[model samples]
Target chain A: MSIHNVIQVEGLTKKFGDFTAVNAISFKVEKGEIFGFLGANGAGKTTAMKMLIGISIPSSGKATVAGFDVFTHAESIKKSIGYMSQKFALYDDLTVKENITFFGGIYGLSRKRIRQKSAVLIEELGLEKVANKLVGALPLGWKQKLSFSVSMIHDPKIVFLDEPTGGVDPITRRQFWEMIYKAANQGITVFVTTHYMDEAEYCDRVSIMVNGKIEALDTPKKLKEQFKVANMNDVFLKLARG
Target chain B: MSICVANISKSYKNVKALQDISFNVKVGELFGIIGPDGAGKTTLFRILTTLLFADNGRATVSGWDVVSDYKNIRKSVGYMPGRFSLYQDLTVEENLQFFATIFGTTIEENYDLIKDIYVQIEPFKDRRAGKLSGGMKQKLALCCALIHKPKVLFLDEPTTGVDPVSRKEFWEMLKRLQQKNITILVSTPYMDEAALCDRIALIQDGKILEIDTPEAIVKHYPKPIYNVSANNMYKLINSLNAYQYIHSVYPFGEFVHYTDKRAEFNAVELKLYLESKNLSNIRIEKTVATIEDTFMELAK
Candidate 1:
């Protein structure tokens, strides 16, 4: 059965003055599904994602995220969705627990809920010993994992992760995906943008953006066959060359 | 005797960069510190190269402690930071000469060590380092690092921005470097590159998850995999994933990789069923699990 659509975009376009960052494009994301966004560096993936997450406004086109209009309901959309950026998104001076609390507070989570969530998240992430430790002192992997958990602290219906696994090891990437699966199983939709073509293969569906246009959108397997390529990398090569 | 890290723990104030990290790189071993940007690979490389100090552990390279004998340790090791930190105004040859002078050596004396890497970019030696392409810059950087003939080399995400073909050529240079019997500690976020390393330390945050040969790690992967591909791939993946018997339906190449969801589901029946879907010309076959798959399996 086709998954119910949770994210809808009709002719989404974003123009930065004269240049079009994200051209008129359209796609939909299903509720509780893992949607991967793939593109090369400087491609419109980030632009399109920023528009969808409400950080960047679209010049034209309409979008609804989690059943809320991305234009007028930007605040409510932000409330219902979590975001993890490409750069590490935690304060280096704060302790592990403090970082979680800070993010939770921003999401307007109750102090009690923050405390409870902190306890569970810390234990689940194997960060109990580092609860009082400063986040800046933590390794890249731990910080990444913690950042991920922090993004979901408020139980947002949708989460936007931007290259959350950029320089992490294979093991950490795997663990990261597991966390994604756990969230997906819990019915939280995941929308992630990444440059790594292989990582794009992990998504239930992926859209490839090039030159502000979504040239290809499909499951990884279909992309390879459609492009007459061996892998997602080849699919991207073909799309980029075109 | 070697590069040894014991119980290293560090935090950046709000982020944990390394947690009880420990490892050893022997002479002549091409050891890879595999992880994403925040995985503490850079922090560890910095600590080992004496660029950064560890908070709660001790590490020694060539018998010089990273914290105490930092100067001595720095002198004996070559380092290529994640970002391009070389002098951009200087020409390619000038940068190499400058690095050589710092280590009390001359480029002529060590010409053989970097000949393979340097020759390709020799034509641009007079060109400023800043103007070179990503691949050429990489070559110059490697040449500069190896000029001193250091016993150990540290490269942090050296292939981040280069093209795939360039990346392959860079790795070939690394293999040649290893033949010179220098211990190499390199970090990369790409999973496919992990297989090329003789041994790797899979790091995240600040912790060491596993240290083993790449082959051994893959040998430990426990999963049965199948490949499925057809026109309109996204719909097929959704359909396959919805099936009760399909466990995982990830895209691998020109095909979607499907596994038995129920664990006991047979491959033969699954192949027939996949053909029944809108997908055609299914190439359903059992294939070897990759490092990424192994990582997922191990992480779970």
Candidate 2:
């Protein structure tokens, strides 16, 4: 892990109307580390991601993503980071290559650069066969890979993935992680949220969110050890039950 | 009565869903139809419940042929679809009663069958199904499905969008439900859940990849699995994958789940190969493969 943090979140609080969606949570993602943001459904994981990505504002406290303030420097932070939500981010009706071009353009890439990046991204994701195919026609696994590749269109310093492999099969998920690993190898820090316990174990470190708070954070091995459990599932069970 | 499906094949417009899929569920058994999304599980479930007809072949649940005895099958089986299609405007209790009434039964008649699950959400009985949480909705749906006292139960990805704790609770409820002699045919994409079933059929791309008891499936795995990790973890995984003897390698947690070309290969030799590749801090250990591992092997 790098000494300098890519993401520094402290006492972060987010509220919607009257409900406190995320309560005073704190954590830091070191540059170049695949940081696992772990939580169950409605555990406020998505809410926290939205705040860190600058889509939703924090109710109080401070959060800087990719060395830019999430509140004041939102646009600059957005430029330095990539994000893939739990829901499909690509338009279903667009061709695979078209989705890539669209996202690249939205990120302010020049047409020439978008074309060049599109080719590299498509080739890396093995989407050459389906470049012209509608994203809806591609398998869920393939679309997830394409979505992840699209997130890094501008070669951002950080990427946020929200359950990137929700419904993908084991083989496809295994392959998806290969792409994540490829990105992490290139010094791109990954901030991903997932309910999948096994996927948590793949991260360099993980933070378990429950009821709008981060209850646990550590490497998967250490979390297992601290909980005296056999796997990440047991660790999650312990934290969730509490 | 046993449930049997023979040569079942169905397709939507221009897409073949099930292609000659065959399987059977023993009486009082908890059977699982395991597969990724769009692997024809829903179609098969619909065929067995007599809602949709197969383009070819036959299926019977509890001694009633789905085609010839459609009404009887509908009366005798419970189905929780992949998507929650319950009347959103209806209260939880209303939904339960509606399903029971449709099957020509009453909640009082089968109250004992669903008491445990129903009681969990009793306070919200007057709440609209759409207003309930994902876990509560699942509970209410299950109660409705069981209200008719069906001899068989078919749940399509019952734990799909729920929390982990609720998923565990749901599976526990199924175990208790099995005590009442109801055979279950459940479909799930999560391989970890596969072990809970009495038997599982691994499906992929509209084909039956494999079907057996979870234990049997794990025992049948042909490769000697090694989970190895090292510094420069990404490079280690890539290097191990690029090894001459590496048959199939995929990332599994902190380590790469690798199987060599030779069954007789040793972990020590594999470790040396990593060293030869100039990888440092390499730690390799032999590990027993889980259902997820077996599924990856089958699918790949």
Candidate 3:
């Protein structure tokens, strides 16, 4: 495998009993690339993502994440990647500082390193005034931003974001994408899934999954051209509806 | 008017959930409440549906006062909350039957009301509600909401987290339902869906920012907007934000929707400035403002 490829998969498949949730899917994610993984509801996106994040075992096929094999080095893969989902990221009862410290500890950061990182993160997000407040008390936009920062506390090689900007205001949503762009510029591979089609255009490459199989995979421009559509939303509607 | 809310205000301890909110929905019109989460949309829906009382002001639904005539309002209106409130353990058919029974009606009496939507999920009638897929569950929820054949329908963020195809299908169903003379008050965070409504009210932080047709709302934007693009999106945004003439810069799809602080701005000059910043392949074109752009400007 080339050193530039951070995530590599070959015919990766996941099945439950008689049902195949994720069919044989193969894709590569390059270093610092923003990859948008999109699909319709019940399209096995969650199943595929679970396998990539090392949380679930793949029933068949070969995959490597962050230079670690999915079958043999799952724990190492976990250590080399960060994950944040819209539903659950940070603890509501914990303060912003406490959430940071707790996640830092989970990633096995040194106490001194955690302290230094927490200071920088709090300042960067302008959360200094709310550092002591419970995460639940903060606005939805603030909590999502903080959750993303805490996910990167360990400085993993790749970060997985699941619908991170769902239901956010238009301004805050753009700010969130700006943060994503910054992370990518700093050489972190972003594997994100979102329901918003406009966000699909922001990715360097996007893969559309349908019925447990990948139906389309390319840059947003190429996908639009290939589908003979003006935008990603129409492209999505055509493929998913079919 | 099918629904009318006047000078409504509600508070929970320190948070003002809704403040002096007022709006009117014409009969048989598809009205939308467009806002993000915690914008007091659900609070307004609750008050109008008579599930919760406002600390001040009053509302009437289907010609009945929300408080004094809540019983009549509840009987004449259908409400689908944001969360899936159906019984998880019940089968789809059972759930539909239960709703029809409660409204003192039968499936045969109102089958025509939900025929198009219900037929899509009819094959899954035997499946448990909890086991249905996201799209199927939404269709089932809509079916339950319409089983009573009410004159008004209240849908709260029905398309939140739902995919594009299903969302499109859901909107089409709403348009068809409008022909039946049902006034629908739907709320969604998606600006794209706002255009599908006959009229929309943009709300934020316990207040209504603006209310008008989506076309009129976009025209309310005070400045010209431009679709600016370059080879490097990240660097392009930072450089434009650092420029002196920048009024607002927000990333929209493949390009950044930008506006200038000056009244008579030159695109060539701005392109030259970006070129000096080592950016290449710069493209700038005048673009129409969208509901999202108008919303951000109003919310700002």
| TM-score of each candidate structure, all chains considered together | 0.64, 0.96, 0.99
The best candidate in terms of TM-score: 3
Instruction: Assign candidate 1 its CAPRI class.
Output: incorrect
Model 2 docking tier (incorrect/acceptable/medium/high)? medium
Per-candidate DockQ values are 0.16, 0.67, 0.92
| Ranking of predictions according to DockQ | 3, 2, 1
**Tens digit of per-residue lDDT, candidate 1, span B22-87:** 888888899888765666788888888887878898999988888889988888889999888889
Q: What does candidate 3's lDDT look like per residue over A7-123, in tens digits?
A: 999999999999999999999999999999999988999999999989899999999999999999999999999999999989999999999999999999999999999999999
Q: Candidate 2 at A104: error in angstroms? A: 1.4
Q: Give the TM-score of candidate 3.
A: 0.99
**Clash pairs detected, candidate 3:** none
- Fill in the DockQ of model 1: 0.16
In the range B105-216, model 3's lDDT, one tens digit per residue, is 9999999999999999999899999999988989999999999999999999999999999999999999999999999999999999999999999999999999999999
Instruction: Decide which is better by lDDT, 1 or 2.
Output: 2
Tens-place lDDT per residue, model 2, A3-63, is 4899999899998899998999988888779999987777898889888888888899999
lDDT of 1: 0.81
Clashing pairs in 2: none
Give the Å error, residue A233, model 2.
0.6
Per-residue accuracy of model 2 over B1-300 as CA lDDT, tens digit each: 479999999988888999999988899999988888778888888889898999999888888999899888888889999889899999988998899888888999989999999899999999999998888889988998888888999999999867678889999999999999999999998888899999999998889989999999999898889888888677887887678888988777777788889858877877788898888888888898988888878877
